[model samples]
Target chain A: MNPVVLCTVARMMAPVLLLFSLVLTVRGHDSPGGGFVGGLLATAAFTLLLVAQPEELVRRRPRVDPTRLAITGLLVALGSGLPALFLGRPFLTGLWAQVPLPGGGALKLGTPQLFDAGVYLLVLGTAMAFILGLLHGEEEEAREREG
Target chain B: MTPPLLLTLPLLVCLGSAALAHLCPRRAWPRRGVALAAMLALTAVGLLLLVEVRRQGVLAVQLGEWAAPFGITLVADLLSALLVLIAGVMGLTVVLYSAATLAPELEAGAYYALVLVLVGGVCGGFLTGDLFNLFVWFEVMLGASFVLLALEAKQEQFEATLKYMTLSLVGSAVLLTAVGMLYGVAGTLNMADLATRLPGLERPGLVSTVAVLFLVAFSLKAGAFPLFFWLPASYHTPPVAVTTLFSALLTKVGVYALVRTFTLLFTQDVGLTHTVLLVMGGLTMVTGVLGAVAQYDVRRLLSFHIISQIGYLLAGLGLLTQEALAALIAFLVHYIFAKSALFLVSGATARASGTYDLQQMGNLYRSHPLLAALFFVPALSLAGVPPFSGFFAKLALIRAALRAEHWLIAGTAAGVGLLTLFSMMKIWREAFWKGHPQDPAAKQEAPSSVNVGWGVLGPCAALALVMGVLGLGARPLLELADAAAGQLLEPTGYIQAVLRRPP
Candidate 1:
């Protein structure tokens, strides 16, 4: 019945769900999952946040404006493409660069995977932003009439 | 990298702009800019693609280099490039008009984001070479469209959108099922590969069933005749800019895919498919014009005309000649500009007078001479009046139909053009000249606040001007359309261009 505890629990799961979404996106090229499904999963995490938080508090705060989150994801995606332009390739050209991870292993980061991450961010951000914006507007309008 | 990157730019611009719009201090400015930038970027890419296709002939990008059957491919030929260009131009005009009028009322970034995704999906549909990928693009575009349509979600809009959504989902499901069955039969999702695999398949009934499913799915989306009831109900409910985008672009995506797949893969079964198309085309034109006659709303009337005009394009596909195809392409280009301009004109009028109901719009000719002309000329052009792009477009289609001895199609085309003029005049009489009587509910009450900013009117007037210019410069476009049609007839150039492997 304590909303703060519920909100904290939801917030704690956000990171875990976000990490899972990343995993889905990274292995997407080789597996059934891709950016779209991953994005939806991430959006679910945010939806949970809304559910756990009190509606009144959530309404006042303007939770992670979907529009802004979508833009940030797009920027990351666009940023990944900048490396291609530097290499004298066209915009959004996918380039794979292998980075040496700790313990004598390598981590591979590339334009395509980054693009997927961007897509994940975009879908999640847009979906949640739209859902909340709509919910907030209706709630505010109702509150005004009641007052 | 080049092909895929160019294709992805529109999507990026669309998604990126929406994201950025939220950060803008003046939300209206960013929303407008996002739409404007996305439109300009798409048009520029289209031009670049046209030049590249001309120089190199069909350009293909194997997304992730996983090869054709395994990975997705974006293939651009003269027709696909031309369609993308048309989408870009229409998008630019609608977005600008939206910025001027609707953006202020909209919840900033979400509206722009949905629009961007819609644009991205259209480009994907135009460029995709794989059957499965085409289905994915279709879903992407339709999903975004549902959000846009239901954005307002008034009682009427909710009703219309629910019907639209249910029907569209059914179409998508049928398309997915067909794709699944095709994959089972051919062992590949690549369209060209499917074509190669199809000739040897022994199951005629299965192929026929699948082909019919494709027709039903595309025709439903295309708003062709029987499946078109949803278009009139829903298109007019949204703000003018949204209506213009959907009316001009979305249905055309269905028509484009239908023509592309049938031309390339299902050519062997044209006897059944073409006959179906021809019958639907005739019914679509007659019924569409009839619907237009019955409607009082400017946007709904234009929506009806969209179905009639689409009928002409379908007629061309049924004929399947080089000339017919050329004429269809030319008509489509003209329709995109003209139809969008007409809707924008309606939006401008609504903003000026605070009503979409034609019965209420009064004496616009006196108060706003420029706006009246802006709306009038396109209405005339849409009716296929002489010296306009619509006239030339109709002339080409008529000539092609006659040459092929498709007498019914030729007669129906001309008849529909006349009916189109009738509906245009009805709007002219009711909205511009006589105007609707003051509403008792709102008459005594001060008029609803209307901000007729330059941001809105300027874009609409500019688009109307472009329609006139496109009408005037029909010769060059006609030649280009002919060339594009010729290329589609022999798709060897497209296949060869994409398959330019290391050897």
Candidate 2:
């Protein structure tokens, strides 16, 4: 099962792919790239790791469960919409604040971006859950057969 | 609460409870408690909303500050608000029934969470003023119902799930395609806006085609005649808790949508569309009652009658008169209360006797006479026996049809009532009148049928009380229905209220 060349390449490519996914997530509201695309990119990187080290990767404790990440992300996104509701506008109406950046451009933030982030995490969590569940199921079936 | 909060609070509570339940799946206490508490709070909110709607005529809240025809809107006229109120009652009742009936493993898993989500979806469907939002809510409702239906992994359940799942998916697909085409035609998804735009379309034929598409999609969900095989096949396979919930609210939501769309957007083609409903409604009533007469299982029989009652609701809508629409509203509320009570009664019967098959059970009339009386109230009402809620409901429907000069439909409804009585009597004779068969296979170790817990009896008793009040005192409710129909018949009030436009 030893494939040093492919394993080494996967390890090298994973972190770079994650960085790219992060960039895609940050600029999502202002431009084409956003949470959903970035989440998929991150998922692709993790999927590569899953393929390369099926046992080692799963054996390690994930800091956050994929489902939990999705749930927390959804809560954050829903919370982002609460400001408008409290301010007597409407549910999920985007409220914005403009902050001048040190680099001379104004940075604007709003709730729609938060909603997109929720969508992104939801996609990521759902994909990972499906894959991990399948992988874990196969392992259990094999163990049962062996026993 | 503000209008927006009033609209969103029940949904938020439901989803928030579901999320909490999902997070703490192992801790049954918090999860179960949270769900029940959410339902209780929702019932209060629903009552308040109904009060507000009654006082204000129509309440509409545009979400995200986007005006009507532009952003999502949640509106609760009397029709929607009253349905929401009934659904809230059903939600609380189902939760109570499940608490006493469902297995510990199920309660500890995603069951209550999914149930909450399903409740949220149904409430959302009733409240949304946008057609696309209604479709989204239907998806949510179907997803949870599918899971709840198939949760039992037996062979019969496996088969039932496949049938239920396939047909439900097809319904959703039809709905989506129709929504897409409607948007293409009118360029708007808001219900009020669509009503204004649909009449202006150049191609009446194409509009009729889309009307037929919606007709098929909604009727499939409503379990109308010739397309309702899935109901009896799958409805009886679930636990009593799920059976009660599904038999009560799910099809009624479809009927609600059909009533809304036909009365609102598709009225331009009422000559064709309403006629389709009239014919289909008559067929559904006759077939559903006949189907019930053939069944030995109590729950399956009740499931068929679910179809029959939907026919009454649809027939009222098809008549397209002021009085007829009032009957639709009245019968809808009456059926929701009485039918759910009947389903819960069946659950108690099953709990006491350990089977859904009427042939296997016996002598409950002698042992638990009070329970038998409880069944008789709703069952007789369902059969339209005099002085009960069902009698008044069917009478109103028939009288409306007669007043509109729909003699054939009036005759069919009257005959369906007779057949409905026969089916109810069939259950009464088989399950109550006959003594237990001596064969070992026919009878289980008989529990003390008279010794019933409040947990199982309380919900049914509450529903029965409401039915009696509706029966003995139909005045207030009939007046309420009058106002509700007034709202539905004249959509201008609703449109202006929702869009905040000049009258």
Per-residue lDDT tens digits of candidate 1, residues B172-245?
Answer: 88889888987887788887677667778898777877888888888888999789877887888887888888
Candidate lDDT scores, in order, read 0.80, 0.85
After superposition, candidate 2 runs with Cα above 4 Å error: A1-3, A99-106, A138-147, B439-450, B501-503
Q: Write the per-residue lDDT of candidate 2 for residues A67-118, one digit (tens) a residue.
A: 7777776676677777878876667888888889998999887788787778
Question: Evaluated on chain B only, what are the TM-scores of all the candidate structures, in order?
Answer: 0.93, 0.96
**Candidate 1, which segments miss by more than 4 Å at Cα?**
A1-71, A74-94, A98-147, B1-5, B22-26, B107-109, B434-456
Which of the CAPRI classes, incorrect, acceptable, medium or high, describes model 1? acceptable
Which residue pairs clash within candidate 1? A66-A129, A71-B19, B100-B456, B359-B436, B360-B436, B361-B435, B362-B435
* Residue-pair clashes per candidate: 7, 2
For model 2 the TM-score comes to: 0.94
| Top candidate when judged by DockQ against the true structure | 2
Q: What is every candidate's C-alpha DockQ against the true complex, given to 2 decimals? A: 0.27, 0.61
Residue B20, candidate 1: alpha-carbon lDDT: 63
* TM-score, per-candidate, Cα-based: 0.85, 0.94
lDDT tens per residue, model 1, A5-66: 88899989988998898789889977878788899988888788778877776657744556
Best by TM-score: 2
